[model samples]
Target chain A: MDFATLLQILDSALRLATPLLLACLAGLFSERAGIFDIGLEGKMLAAAFFSAAYAYITGSVWLGLAAGCIASMVLAGIHGLASITFRGNQLISGVAINFLAAGLTVLIAQNWFEQGGRTPALEGAARFQNITLPFSETLAPVPVIGPIYSQVISGHSALVYIALLAVPATWYILFRTRFGLRLRAVGENPAAVDTSGVSVTGLRFAAVLICGFLCGLAGAYLATGLSANFVKDMSAGRGFIALAALIFAKWRPWHALGACFLFGLLEAFGNRFQNLSVLGVDVPVQLMQALPYVLTVVILAGFVGKAIPPRAGGAPYVKER
Target chain B: MPKWVDVALIPLINLALALAVSMLVILWIGESPFEALAIMVKGAVGSAYGWGYTLYYTTNFIFTGLAVAVAFHARLFNIGGEGQAALGGLGVALVCLAVPWPHWTLALPAAIVGGALFGAAWAAIPAWLQARRGSHIVITTIMFNFIAQALLVYLLVGPLKASGMSPETAPFPDGAALPTAHDIAPWLGFRPSAPLNISFLLALVACAGVWLLIWRTRLGYEIRAFGHSEPAAVYAGIHPTWIIMATMLISGALAGCMAINSVMGEAERLVINSVQGAGFVGIAVALMGRSHPVGVLLAALLFGMLYQGGAELEFEMPAISREMIIVIQALVILFTGALDNMVRMPIEKFYDARRLARQRNGRGTGVAAE
Candidate 1:
């Protein structure tokens, strides 16, 4: 109700929204290219563990970021290999990747650190320290805009800025570029794209790789930026939530950002307020925590306009030739 | 080349591939793969006690696997088995705790009906959304899993806790407990005190019932027809809405039956996190089994071995932790389900080539004799 409280809630919402935003964009690329990637959670989990492990070993956050991306890319490549090259079921491949990541991350972490499937706590250069924006001190003396600039906009990890910037970048690539056109065409109808003399597989593989890159950044931020270490199943269900957000947005990049913020705000409120009462009634905490999922279901069920997926999504393409 | 190949050889080959990869992982972990395999075998089936535990786990997997397989028959992915099973536990707890039954026999049926109804009710929303509103079943079912967990947490912490600090209910009444495997172990010349219970018999009966329903009944025909081709089934006058709703209700009921084993037989209380990833494990089981009742039984037993063996592996070789078993399970699922065509296509091609050579040779001999 108060301004400061509202500002604090918004700040938490932004922080929570960053990972969801990155992952939504990741799914955007994969789905736009006709690949349904339910394994985003698994990819993020793998990236989180590898990033934290490498970061702890090298004491360099940059190296950790690289390792995280590579780890995710490897998984994305495996998914591509299974679903595309082998012409396997995409959902099954995604499920396998989730199980594989859940098991291997903990197994390897135990072998290396012996800390019950967790990486060592990161600090200093090993972690993504918050960046206070320029003129924060000068801005603090200003009126309402001062706190808005310093408190709400500034003091976020660098990855937060990257995630915010990725929205427009994704929009530009998806709607403005030649590759984007090909990607969209491939998802809608691979046969049309193939006849156009563009290799359908190549475009899809490219999109999946970009998905891997963005998911990696999201996972890295969760480990090295938001939290200090990797824990078992730390990605939890964020990947699925991102998928929900993606569907809620109807595959648009800008709408995906809005959806992520909405879900993030729900999560923030759930965390802050254990219980709420409206008028003379009581509202349960479980219902509050479930609001995002409930809303996504309602939206999908045509309470909002129908959320149509890519036409060729989840099907492996095969050329008759 | 034959029906047997698809039914038997393919699964065996996939199992071999998964185990081979697991062996490599073990080697990488600085343990002898042979030793790990030996220990796992001994741990899972070597003793009466081990068999007891294996069968107990097998019971849980079988119920969940059948749940998944039933929905799969109608081309519906019911990923909410975890949630359904959780709610089923709530149902069983409510019935068992609400009234002091005169006997275990009377209480068993009540619990089963209660569990099935609750689980089916949980699944109905997702099924309706998928059938009527065009929402994706996979997404809704998955979301339901999270909501189910949160709901269970709230109940256990608030209304269900029985005057204790722990987030679990008190034990059920004396008459509510199912007969454990220990009661039967003596007559079978086995050791007593294993957790295997009467629910295992129920699982066997359910398997038989599923087999009959799938192979002998008209409804099963409609379900399979719909799964094979939705347009064809629709043209044949089968309503998609009815098929979807009916199939999911059956699936949810089977999933809820798992509570009979974990809640009534083993724990005898409503506990948090009781499902313990068994619902997802059922997906792997159904996949490996190829959705056949007999195959599901076999796959469930194998997973049961992996689970019990994995526990043993941790005790025998600390380097190979329990999570390693999950890695193995994932590999099996990956090979059997996702990469099924990878091995199948090559084998089919090999058989085709061999048959072609035989035919040509026969023709060449006839020409020479003429």
Candidate 2:
């Protein structure tokens, strides 16, 4: 590929990776706190619908973002009540929330808008605009790195920068902070954390709510920033793809960025080259699309390296007499 | 404390709560809950035509629900019913299309084996991974669902697309067609186009077979033993690997049999999205039914009614879309599965309070009798 083409693909890659990165970090927080969330998809979908719905209604992107986060947090709260408060099966609760989001989004969309479960497309300030870095124009006349900076790094929605910035933020919070240490301890062994005079339930719910907040950003980026309107099931399988990326990255923040970016690059290539071939043999695009899932399955099966989840994950905590 | 209360009363209360919440949602949508409920009831059971569609959907759920229930008996969760049923559709297509049959009687047996084997094969990989490598089946199964969809879409749009226009296979020959409701119960004057077919009887047989296998056989005893306590089952000479694989196979096969109803029986062609959300519905059914075959049957019928009635509601009241059924289904799962603890604890506390009051009244002899 030419450098220009590669840069274009990279630009799209960055755009695509933003949502995955945010959702992956969201999963990282929840699963690190011993909460297995298969409902990430549903949560993102709810946020997507609400963000678009609100953005279209109020014509203020900030309100839409706030509404998105609150909507996602509500579902996160439901997950907390079911799994933590009631001590029910975490996986079952996640599954129910997913269905809840999936059904409620389309139902509410159809009720409010008569256009078949879709909000009217947003234009102008109701949607996120691409942000060009300050030096983008000045560096345009330089060498290869100039155009790369201008095209790939400079021009992206603000959410993309936020997603990129979150990698470091997550690392700092998860490894360098007292709360992060407690959160990790709660996931690995809640009883130990409880014995240390920390409330295990409080830390876990905090992690879950933070997860909701990040997912809110991701979903809003999709509807209002990426595509301009909410489409039915618009989150698609990206949440699962994010989960797969989280597992592939072994639950590390920086590694999550790499994994999501790589998956995004694959999608970019698939979209760019519809009739891709390798060594005189045709390669189906579906294979590329399915790679994240296939890779996660392979990793989980221990065919490559082991990817163990949080030690206390998927189990509700109970105090023994 | 009582068997009937645990089995019947708690589920009733949970269902009532789910319906109440659903009604509230209807009211929020600016519709009359009572009117919607009346329309749904009248549409689902008021006529032979409604019964036909309800039973058709009931048959689909029966196959998938039993699949989940048998696996639940072994303490295994098989959520790949969607993928398995998709493969089952491929199997049915091959059986009914690849070879010529003089009549559906001959084709039915062959299609059943084809569907069961394909579904079982798709499930075997995840089962083996879970049993041998200690990989979680939940992760593997959900991933396999995405892979299955990708694979089927590739095939349907490429090699399997016989019509060259749509992403579907050519219709099977007339001889391969299953007998519809009108063929058997013409006296009732059901709609000729209704999809209630001979596969409904097959679904009934599957329920009976699953019941016998779970409660009446040695393997069933082993399965229940394993589910109750792994260490004890192992001590009793039960092979965990065998139980896991065998239960999953049975589960996948049952999920596959659903193709007999939806794919070959209804569509008469292999199409993308043939499984729809029936596989996930099976999870809700199995949970609501308490993993019992009889319970699965009842839950399946309830869902079938919702599905048929939801369609009617969508037609009669365009404002209330068909997705309302999905919202109701989600509520049922939320109430009956994840939040059941919320429902059960209150009832348990009530029973405990009553028992305590009885003991305080100098009727403590009743406790010993219990």
Candidate 3:
């Protein structure tokens, strides 16, 4: 392929990867603390709806993003209450949260927008503009790698930069900090953390809330940066894909970034190959669309190395006196 | 203080909470909450047509519930029921369309068996993957659901598409179509107008069969014992891995039966998205029923009623979105989970109290006897 075409594909892939990357980081934080956050999809959907609506109304992308994060946090708080306080099954509670968010968002969207199941499209001021790194114009004269560097490496929504930066930030907070030690302790053995004078509940709740914030930002990136409008179920299994990435990466922040990008690349290519049918030689679009999910299953099923989760993951710990 | 009151309290509490939440949503949408609820009640159970629809919906749930419950009994979570059911439908549909069986008697059995085999094969992959690799079934099954959807869409829109039809297969041949209520009414002495079919009977029979399989047989005993404690069961000479795999195969087969009810019984053709949330709904049914055959049957009916009612609310009250059904399902799951948690706590507390009481009483008796 030509350099320009390759650059275009790479840039598009990066934009597409942005949402999954953010969601992977979000899932990383929660799972690291032993909370299985399967409701990431619901949080992302709710955030995307609210952000798209707010952006369309006020024409301020920042306001829209803030609203998205707040809305997602509220849902996350409810999940915390249900699973943590009530000691409900973490998986079931997460599924319920997803169902609730999906239904509620569509219900409100239909009522308010009367657009069936989509928010109003945002204008220029309400959407993020692509960034051009300094001296890219001077470097544009070079052949081949120049376009790849300028277009794919440099130009992207601001959230793309944030998602890339979050890998190290997440790693540091999860491994190097005191909070990280306590979080790990809670996941491994809540009793030990409790005996060590750390409130297991408080730390886990904080982890879930941080998960909510990151998922909200991820949703905002999807609606505002990737697409100007939010459609029903627009997260479109990306959150679940992120969860898979988290597992595939063994719940490590930096590794998850790479996994998310890999999955995202597969998705981007799948979308691109939709209309490339040759005479009497063709691959169905549905099969291509199914690639990421199939890959997830294959990877988890030992096409890759063994994946080990946190010891106490998905268990609700209650101290025995 | 009454025995019946205590026994009935949890379901009642759950129903009340579900109603209240639904009513609040209806009110927020500027609809008459009471009227909407009445419509739901009437639509689900009050009339013959409503009953037929409820029963029809329940048939699918019952099959899928059994699918999930079977795996739960073996302590294996089978979340791939959706994919299994879809594959089952595809199998049945393909058999019905392609098989050249001249007799209805031959075609029907062949199609059903074909569906079961396909579903069993599909589920075996995940079971094998989990058994061999220690991979989590939840993630594998969830991924498989997407793959199944994509495959179904592709087949419907491509190779399997009927001539001159749009992304849908041709209706099954007369010999292949499931005998509906009208078709069988003459022999059974029932009204010809009902929508209910023989699938309900098949579902109930399947439920009974499942109960017998899990309660009476040697295999059932081993499966249940394994569910209670895998290590203990293994020590007792039961192969846990083989049993788990067996449970998944049975579950997937039952899920295949669910797809048959929709494809052969109702639609008379396989359509993309025909499973339509039934697989996920099966999870809630299995959970609410606590994985018992009888309980699953009853819970499936309850969910069927709610689903029918939710649809009725949309037609009678346009102000409320049909999405309320999803919200109600969510509420049911929430309340069911809460009730399960509540029941466990008090039971454990009671056991603790009884143990302590026995210890003190034993000490006093020993002193007196001495």
What is model 2's interface RMSD?
0.8
Model 2 stretches astray by more than 4 angstroms: B357-362, B365-370
Q: If ranked by DockQ, best first, what sequence of candidates would result?
A: 2, 1, 3
Cα lDDT tens digits for candidate 3, A136-208: 8888777876776788889887889999999999989989999998887787888889998889999999999
Residue A273 Cα positional deviation in candidate 3, in Å, after optimal superposition: 1.9
lDDT for each residue of candidate 2 in A1-321, tens digit (9 for 90 to 100): 799999999999999999999999999999999999988898899999999999999998888988998999999999999888888888888888888888889889999998898999998888998998998999998999899999999988888999999999999999999999999988999999988889989998999999999999999999998999998889988999998899999999999999999989988998899878999999888888888889889998898999888999988999767
CAPRI accuracy category, model 1: medium
What TM-score, to 2 decimal places, does chain A of model 2 have?
Answer: 0.99
Q: For candidate 2, what is the lDDT? A: 0.91
Q: What CAPRI-style quality would you assign to candidate 3?
A: medium
User: What TM-score would chain B of candidate 1 score versus the native chain B?
Assistant: 0.95
Specify the highest-TM-score model's number.
2
* Cα lDDT tens digits for candidate 3, B312-356: 877887656788888887777766753345544565566567666
Candidate-wise lDDT, in order: 0.91, 0.91, 0.82
Worst 10 residues of 1 chain A by lDDT: A275-284
Residues B133-167 of candidate 1: C-alpha lDDT, one tens digit per residue: 88889989988888889899999988898888899
DockQ for all candidate structures vs. native: 0.75, 0.81, 0.62
